[model samples]
Target chain A: MKLSREEVVHIAALARMSMSEAEIEKAREQLAVILENFEILKEVDTTNVPPTAQSINLQSVMREDIPGESLPAEKVLANAPDREGDLFKLRPVLE
Target chain B: MTDKYTDLTIHSAHELLKAKKLSSVELTRYYLDRIGKIDQAVRAVVTVTGDLALRQAEKADKLIAGGKDGPLTGVPVLIKDNMCIDGIRTTCSSKMLENFIPPYNATVVEKLNNAGAVIVGKANMDEFAMGSSTENSAFFTTHNPWDLSRVPGGSSGGSAAGVAACEAVYALGSDTGGSIRQPAGFCSVTGLKPTYGRVSRYGLVAFASSLDQIGPLTKDVLDSALVMNVISGQDPKDSTSVPETVPDFTKGLNGDLKGMKIGIPKEYFVEGMQPEVDAAVKEAIRKLEELGAKVEWGVSLPHTRHALAVYYIIAPSEASANLARYDGSKYGFSYQDTNNMWEGMEKTKQLGFGPEVKRRIMLGTYALSSGYYDAYYLKAQKVRTLIRREFNQAFEKYDALVTPTSPTIPFKIGEKADNPLQMYLSDICTLPVNIAGIPAISIPAGFAKNLPIGMQVIGKPFAEETIFKISYAYQQVTDWHKKTPKL
Candidate 1:
């Protein structure tokens, strides 16, 4: 399982991260070693096994859909890096 | 006070508080003084909430005076930075949120507060709980209290070291793979990872949601049980939290494990495991046998080899989804780029998160992406199921499974920093329990070359009572849990 540089770039882009060429190369090698080690699972017979999403065998524990006190708008925006009157401002998404 | 304070467990501390021998303020101050002196070299604490802790201690003293003292009344505890504490800086040891203060408390934090426990401070962790060693923490690396140069097994290294140093009576830590247990092993503390969903994840900064669980790092099994009792209950805020009644976990502490069936998995004893660790674990098992527990060798978790791989894929996949909310918009660092919002997001994440965190996010994004979902993410899920079924079969014949909590002892800080694969292997033995969502505990087994080794005792789902019984019984017979680092 060889992870190509291009694949690394694609992964980084999807993850919202930027990587240098050197880091991409290093990631390619490391990811390949991990992927190769994982190949051992190929020999195990999982035909009858059901995928376990969570460790506890539990069903949904839903809460009543009720209204709750909302944080003040100023409090919500207090931590934002950039904001505009209850709206978070960002660099323009589309040209 | 030094003699009384040196080895005081939460149980004893509460007893003293009730008898007026020790005030909550005095206890909190004692710990703060200890942290001030010892934490300089170890760097275990990232933020010390001295004022808030003292305020809570005063409140607890008032409660004790009013005859409302609880089991953990006036006990001071450290929380891993990843768990949100309202109005306190919850950094997760990353530069990204270095200045961020959570507006609300995490469920576990709220529970501890309600139980009369004082929040002493926030402990350091790998940035966003992403690394095996605290070196990855952007703030500072926490050194093992046993050997200042060696790494405290992480990303719960701070919690483990805090308990080891007696800086806090007990601390709360989250374990995704080996975060709590490995650090506990290294620091010679008792740490447990309750069955997944046992502790609510309402205010936890999600690492790998499915694999992550909040548990206690304590000076001994009894204190672990004390903290677990307060925190292990369902919360309406977290959808994944189980609604089952949390039993009085301390109730079975004195229950004899005389005829209990203990399983020793052959797979965990595989080659490459440190010989000293192997000997320590075996000695602990022999002691359990001497204490009247029956030991049986059994096959377990044939797919155990795939745990690390599957964990890397699944954990990061969930992490990617969870961390997506940390865009420049909501909280944390944001890049100023007039070009475009997506470009700004890319720049913010790239600049904010450390290399290992970014690497995982990338791996997870790739695995969960449109074209690769079936080949990687879904396939890993199937393997995870197989792993759980294997444990179910083993538990049918055995009451508990025993293994070395960590395959090897703690490594030097920089030894495995560059090798991501080497770092991932640290979690190998501990990952299976999380994958199966079963209760598991790491107790101080014995020392290997002066460093601590931990023995893991894993029990069935919602069987924390069994874990407590086994651990408490073992602690009674052996003094491993009593030894402290001569820092």
Candidate 2:
């Protein structure tokens, strides 16, 4: 049930988290214990059971396509860590 | 003991306000003073909106003067930090949003404001509501009001502690897995997780969309019901919030349980639970029977054993997706030292989240990864269906189910903090109710070893009134809830 170091780094990357060597090892050990416990679900007979993504039935929530008041540009940009004229300023997308 | 404003329940305060015996301003100031003096030890309150509360209290007084006051008018209430209030910092007890302020108020906040509730700032919580103990908070661990050395149970620990210490008249808490009820039990206060979709999630920060719910931690069940009446209803903002009618939750507190059916599922009283926890909940169930409930013991929910696995998988999967919004460019903490945007995003996520948060994200990513989807995520969902069905079938024969809110009394701060599985096991008794999307309430059943034990009363979906009825009747006959921590 032990998770390999490479597997831990792989999943952390997929989760958009950068981990140091120590963090990777700690996460690997902890996740191995947690994921090992997930083995319990295999005992349940879910042969014919359909997956339930939602407990209550869902329907398309429709709203009129009419224009309505929305948050002002200043308000939306207020929390931006770095912004340039109502747009979030991120570093170059490509190196 | 001195008679103080902090000791008043919402109902009693409402009466005083209506009769002009207690001014809203006076009441708000008294609570502010108490929190100012006491919250330092408990660490329950994160932000104290003394000015905003005073302003809101003044407005509420105006409404009362004009004969426009409702039950919650002028009531000082604390919100779990995850819920947004315009111009206030909504941290979710995470460093990612340490300075993040919301542009708008959450739907429940708006509802409370509309009902003239005085906003008393925010309460602490586990980081992103991830862990069972508030020790996961990046800021500081919220100490249990009853015993300062132990944890307050979380991620609603601060909310429960606030009410237990009489800091707020009542406080709002959010539950995904036993977050609200567990802490409520630990603090010896009343807590309720309304049916999923019963209350809107519009402005509340999302943790796990399907499992997360907004509820109240109050001094008593009647106060919880009073708050629910104001906050429960349909909201057009959150699509998941069902279009259902909200009942006057306080109307069912007639102390009547005659002919109502209650089920005691043996699966909940598991091995290794504290013997006193089992005994206290058993005594509460006997009280239910005495109140004329047709109590049926030895009931079985065979699929109950697998709930923890299903919940860990499903909740984290939803959380990984829900939390992807915090990439640092738009809002929340951002890491900008790197020239490459992707590197910046990754570093921001790495530094912003705590260890528990990172662990969940990793678990989620692995479960949804390409080759493993069907084995972990999909299989968990299928088992979720079985667990939900088991509860659905049990409800067909019973109006409610009774169980201990937590498996043991509140543990020391670091007892299970590092061991993730042991912390997860603490919530075993209360997890299935969330997986099934039903309503449940935890009330003060008794004290063991000088610590409080909570008995969970669970009801069918949208059957909060039945839950209130059962717990309220028990409260009538028992004096356990009447005993608050002498902080």
Name the best candidate (by DockQ): 2
Model number with the top TM-score = 2
Off by over 4 Å in 1: B1-4
Residue B123 shift from truth in candidate 1, angstroms: 0.4
What is the two-chain DockQ of model 1?
Answer: 0.71
Question: Residue A80 lDDT in model 1?
Answer: 87
For candidate 2, chain B by itself scores a TM value of: 0.99
Over A1-95, each residue of candidate 1 has an lDDT whose tens digit, in order, gives 56988888888887877787888888888778877766676776667667767776567655678998987777668888888888987766666
Write one digit per residue (lDDT tens) for candidate 1, span B14-51.
99999999899999999998889889988899999999
User: Which CAPRI quality tier does the interface of model 1 achieve?
Assistant: medium
lDDT of 2 by residue, B40-128 (tens): 89999888999999999999999999999999999999999999999998999999999988999999999999999998879999999
Evaluate model 1: give its lDDT. Answer: 0.88
